[model samples]
Target: MDRLTLRLPPDLVRRFDAAAAGRGGRSRFLRRLMEEAAQAPLPAPVAATPAGRTGKLTLRLAEADLALLEAEAAVLGLSRTQWSVALIRRRLQRRPQLTPPEAVAFIEVQRELRRIGVNINQIARAMNTAVLEGTVLDLEVAQLAAFGDEIRAHLTGLRAAFEGNLAYWSDGT
Candidate 1:
């Protein structure tokens, strides 16, 4: 690829030069900019790929704002650059508005899981009450225990569904 010279305003150039000195060489930063301009779409301000290294990409940010991004990134389980990438992706990506159909389905599933969990808990309580309050034959007790185990299996399935939904919406972040 041919290298092109970009004329920046004096202040911005000074900032970029200083930022480059803090991390690595200025050429590396320039190369990254060239790569991004080639790969990144004109509409979106962020890198299309998550964690596109832009530590040396100087944005005119207050030090406090930078610290806040770092803090938020730590909380979100990403580095500062990854967090910035996520912000960019959020801005540039034409977000798929959750379809009404999907929204309804998700809501229904959540409600059903809650209802089922409540029912399972209630049943467990009843079983406990039955065992503690009444003299239970071994066979009867075993049947109740088996039923409880079935309820537990169903709960596990609900948990799996919940996790799957979360992963599906996370968009590889």
Candidate 2:
């Protein structure tokens, strides 16, 4: 790997950092960008189309956002505009139509479920590390096992709550 130093404008740097934060870190983000650029299809000429075949929509993005879009488009073997249109269409098509209050409640439930999952992961990791170190006493292992059971109970409740809502809209609900 080669190391390169870049001197970018402060505002651009801020935007880049923000984008990188969403994707783990700067190095991974830049590596993905380079890979995308390497694999991008050659730009093709735009041809005249029949009337009403398609319409144009223009957007102005931060440099960081544009780079991300370009990378994603490259991965999909699509032009940036085509990729954006496809993504937007899929989002609109797939999402459920919920009342504002129902939407809020659904999002809250999802967030809580995610939080519980994270907590469960942390507890499992701690138990695994203790076992690997050969320091987990019998009583401590039993406690951890009990805690795991409790996490399973919470997960069951969350699943029941989600099912009770009966708001599966994607499959022609």
Worst 10 residues of 1 by lDDT: 94-103
Q: Ten residues in a row with the worst lDDT in model 2?
A: 164-173
Best-fitting candidate, scored by lDDT: 2
lDDT of 2 by residue, 1-173 (tens): 68988878999999999999989799899989988998998688888897879677879899999999899677646678766765565457653334345567667766776776677677678767765444456555666677677667767865665454333323334
lDDT of each: 0.66, 0.69
Tens-place lDDT per residue, model 1, 1-173, is: 67677768999988899888855679988778777889976674664656754445657679999899889777656687766655655546633323345456667766776776677577667767775544555555566576667667766875676566455335576
lDDT of 1: 0.66
